[model samples]
Target: MKTLFILFFSIPLLSACSGGASKINGHPNIVYILADDMGYGDVSCFNENSQIHTTHMDRLADQGMIFTDAHSNSAVCTPTRYGVLTGRYAWRTRLKDGVLWSYDEHLIAPERMTVASLLKKKRYRTACIGKWHLGLDWEKDEEGRTLLTRPIKNGPNANGFDYFYGITASLDIPPYLYIENDRVTTVNIDTVEATSGKGFWRKGPIGDDFKHIEVLPRLTDKAVGFINTQSKQAEPFFLYFPLPAPHTPILPTNEFRGKSGTNTYGDFVLMVDDVVGQVMAALDQNGIKDNTLIIVTSDNGCSPLADYNELAEFGHDPSYIFRGHKADIFEGGHRVPFIARWPAKITAGSETDEIICLTDLMATCAAIVGVDLPDNAGEDSYNMLPVLMGEKIAHPIREATVHHSVNGSFSIRQGKWKLEFCPGSGGWSPPTPEVARQENLPPIQLYNLVEDIGETNNLTQQNQQIVENLTALMKKYISDGRSTPGSAQKNEGETPLMMD
Candidate 1:
């Protein structure tokens, strides 16, 4: 009787041990999908009045927590990407004034920590699979023929990405061709020509096989292919899929065109939705859906072309009642769509309004993997895992959030109050002849976001005390290299005064 009893207990113990082993080996796969120049209202989940339906993106929101008050650190692509990878504001870097060109050298310094590098230390397979607009040193000769320069350095590969397949800059920009690691897939400068195709830019070496209209579909195909290929590998992977759709040249695939009644921009958004669906399908096909975390967001708000008077007549408000688009230091310019889904960790159909930034992604991933960032790394990132899991209530992750405009204007947000350093709209509007004539406006602007989501009211004169307090906070953050995690850098010169 005693032997039989002991045998029964041993059987259960063996089963328990097997289950524990499986659990120990299971690490969640992570995929971060970032869109370029997509607005808060562009996604149907966030904008009720959006004429177009982003079914896949909306489904993603339904499966995870939707962040209503999320924002990008900068109002443009390159800066926002820098913050996303390094978890530090782009303004702190030497290239503080503007973004880089296609031929520009690597923007990310080798010493700087990146999301891919940090994850690599923890044994994660990292790959950047889409638009890499952060800049890289393209191989070129004096004759202008693309040559094999020293192995591509100081870019994604040097920054910790195990594999990279993308472009050096926006689709409309020059040197238009797919870059696979250190070499261009198809190089031909002789056949290159400058064309004014829709919103296309001039002077680029485009491949003969490449067309401005096919970029979005091609990028989507590459992203889906990468996910499938990486899933077969032994190590769990982290895929940074920054899509090039809905940004410029608004070229949706023929099948997707005219599908949305809104216009070309709307059609482009639909293509983006299809891309999301393809990614999700790939994850499921690989049998890793249950163990993968997928996040979808934008680099910043929509562009002014979506707001050009003719486009606006169709009843599309890219900013969706927010003050400005793309380059302004306002809510419409910086606020963006953020959705994260992890079937095992985050509850489906959840939502949160806590203010968060793309810069926080590095810290959040670090916290999930049970790692701590060194002082120099992720100096601006705040871990949002608790908030994401619906475990925290009312506790704010950030005390203040900083914003940068296209023309290098600055703004700081603390709680509901926001302060902008420049007077007129800090982007294309400022240098315009008509806006320059408006002498009644102050040189600085302040708004209470809680009361003025549209930013129609500027209270710089009425609220002197709030302005002083927020301005001091903003100045301190600017003088310091980062606002949250690291020590402040000592100002070498006289600090800029806090404007009222």
Candidate 2:
């Protein structure tokens, strides 16, 4: 493992590397702010009639490029997070369906190259702060209880990040203790019961200092401190700021409570917006705003726990015009508001409908630092640096994008067409797989997304050839163990991680 001091000492020599338009100062610092369970319609810029005005997020969009077609690789947290870090789809791994439990072992293979590891290769100091749902291997007692006594094995620190500070999983999950680096911030834990309704969470152990309402603010403060600490350093830093906000335990501070005038969920979103503002402010206060490449997006769509019906009563729809919420094989399930700002390269207030996935972070960063990725790494990543630089691309950057539902349903999108293998929503939404089957729906579904973005109409019967083509492409992606242009690589497991 090469240290930053060793690699960064030769920055002048490395600047000779080609590909990106690197500045004399150095490669731009990258700050990836990932919001958990925030929906496309939650942000005012993405949703015209949105009730919660995400002022900071909207300003970020105003200063950078807003990707209208950006999507998470999966409609869930763990898998989508895996894709973001590893630049590979999580479904290809053994944990086929659903999310990882708090007690589950760490997911990323030890040898895998992650965004943090790659950035560190370029002498960029990497740190991850906030929720890491990708699993952590914890020590256990003879009674089979989790013990956060020592440094976690194969945790974030082991996977490329120089520093790690955050919870193990969603706020709603149990054992609500903060982990800074590999050790617990505090060992004082008490059993806490699950809360019902909007502020819902499973019953679990919680540290004395861990308050549901304070988690968001604590994480934000930590991020600001990190930025302040890095301000004096010449070397650029990479902060993977993943927020566990507006997700669950919908705990909004008193100052933001009732701010949205909609509901607790709406208030929580406003708080999330405040978090973005705080991060941006930190950058500005530290004089790192202009050169920093700030990209903000969500892990997945809004969870139904947001109470859509209640939001509808306030004339606010979290999913916006899209059909379903999270965990479904619909546009809303995966499509998210992706905003990036980099004054050095990206045009201000620019917007592109260029289709992109979170997995692209790896290759884009690699391109920025002028590192050509080996075939084995970033298998599903596509470089959108050109699109970010206002380049007029003649063809789509991706041959087609793949989406996965919580139930492991597969959907492939190319241009305007989207095909799903499951019979229905394939998740929590109505017309579930069972319902669709009972209603005699076809085993597969095809939609012309361009003509019918809502996906209300099924064109499977009329477009057999298109369906076949997409199916074949999906199969090739599976058999070849990758979607991007590369030599055939084997998947981690025997199961194909897809439906016909």
Candidate 3:
């Protein structure tokens, strides 16, 4: 383990690192590619023992910086996406548990300030090109039946993106069709059989051209096309390429079907890596590689559907050394692989252990454009530009990062000590919520992550004082509404925190 320090003077380095005229107005083109239910160990570069090889992801990591301790704001898709774009925890909103389904109302309010909306203020061409699980408003017919004719009123287009090319929710959900900007490309009048067991997609109405296997490839083509188009423009652009693979209906294209030498999920990961290669090649062909800042990360940990038993037989532990998978409060659920490539700025092959959350992107981008965000916005985001520039920031960038599970379980982390408010996994591990309550398990659990990264030992009974301190801090963060220093705001609803 390396002892890293934060030295705050990195703004000057940003200017010095600006390579040439390729930079548009002192800012680089930003492309954020988020993977769905991809594990930290899925990428070979992140885990040496990983059986699934991701050559493109490895090369990208070698060319840039990797955050060893990076995490998504929540251990699920919709909530994490909301936190990433809005710079606030999703728990603060009305959706405290589970996720948004297709045909649900838009989660992002019309007045909410998102990363896309914020970047638009600086004249950046913004586009969201895949898996928009944050929710949308659907039109209805005279008979109260859902209608796909009219364009969605408050979707990605209304939330600040100039264009939106993606699906309304997970590929497994109903009304399977592609959405361009605000309108569905075609109406879903035909019903598709349930693809469960093979991958797990519910039976629903699907568009004529909407094939489960073709979604990833089509999205890759669109993302590459968007990059090529930007080459002709003088303004920097922001592309949020959220992939919808390795999550459900693990349908790997024919070309990538047998590539991983593992299961279908592994093959799907290889397909995702190929998409990364395509995006990188597009930047190269456009001569924008030097001026483009590429980011690759996952929304959360791997899902159980990836076939943990089969993968383990092949020497691949998707969650690496962590205990639980996707929805747990443990490391495996929230910690994800994060790699950033900026040829004009970041040193190649650099790695950092700085604790950071996905929500930090809002403030990081704000700092890149030299804009001061209002006190009301990006309240939970911290500027990690210094870390990106390989400089040590003077003050602590974050006091602590809060973790959320699919079941609305809450956990707080400050340095090495972590306090989980729930007794069991709070997700999908042994002693299910029902079982834990029946057996009369302990009320809370605590772990010093520095000593026990696996969270095998519980220190709650011994460290009552530490537990009390962290518990108080979590409460304060909730009451204050905003985590970072700013004006205190009001939570959209009361959080059902079980803390006494």
- Cα lDDT tens digits, model 1, 1-500, are 00000000000112332221112224555677888888877888888887778899888778877888988988888888888888988777765645777777877778888988887877777888777878786566789754533356566888898888887777767777777777667745444555553455566567665777777677678777877776666566678878776777677777987898877878888888888888888877766665566778888888765544545666667677687777777787789888877776789999888999889988987886778888778878998878867785666999889988776778888888898877766665443213633665566778988999877788998999998998888877777766776666532234343222
Ranking by lDDT: 2, 3, 1
Per-residue alpha-carbon lDDT of model 2 for 372-458, expressed as tens digits?
989899999999889987988999999999999988899999989999988889888989877887898878888887889999888
Task: Give the alpha carbon lDDT tens digit for every residue of 1-500 in model 3.
Answer: 00000011111123433322243564657778888899988989999999999999899889998999988888888999898889999999999988899978989889989999988887788899988988888888889788876868899998889988999888888878998998888854688988777488998888887888888889889988987887567677788888887789789878988889989989988988888888888877765666666778888889888899999999999899887888888888899888887776889999998899898988988888888989888878998878887887775589999999888989999889989888777777665556767787787889999899999899998999999999998998899998898989888889967722
The residue ranges of model 1 lying beyond 4 angstroms of the native Cα positions read: 1-25, 139-151, 197-199, 429-440, 489-500
2 Cα displacement, candidate 2 (Å) = 33
Q: Candidate 1 or 3, higher TM-score?
A: 3
Global local distance difference test of model 2 = 0.83
Those runs of model 2 whose alpha carbons end farther than 4 Å from true positions after fitting are 1-25, 497-500
TM-score of each: 0.90, 0.94, 0.94
**Candidate 3 TM-score over all chains jointly:** 0.94
- lDDT (CA) per prediction: 0.73, 0.83, 0.82
Q: What is the lDDT of residue 297 in candidate 2?
A: 84
Clashes of each: 1, 0, 6
Q: Which stretches of candidate 3 lie over 4 Å from their true place?
A: 1-24
| lDDT for residue 294 in candidate 2, whole number 0-100 | 76
What's the true lDDT of residue 18 in model 3? 37
Worst 10 residues of 2 by lDDT: 1-10
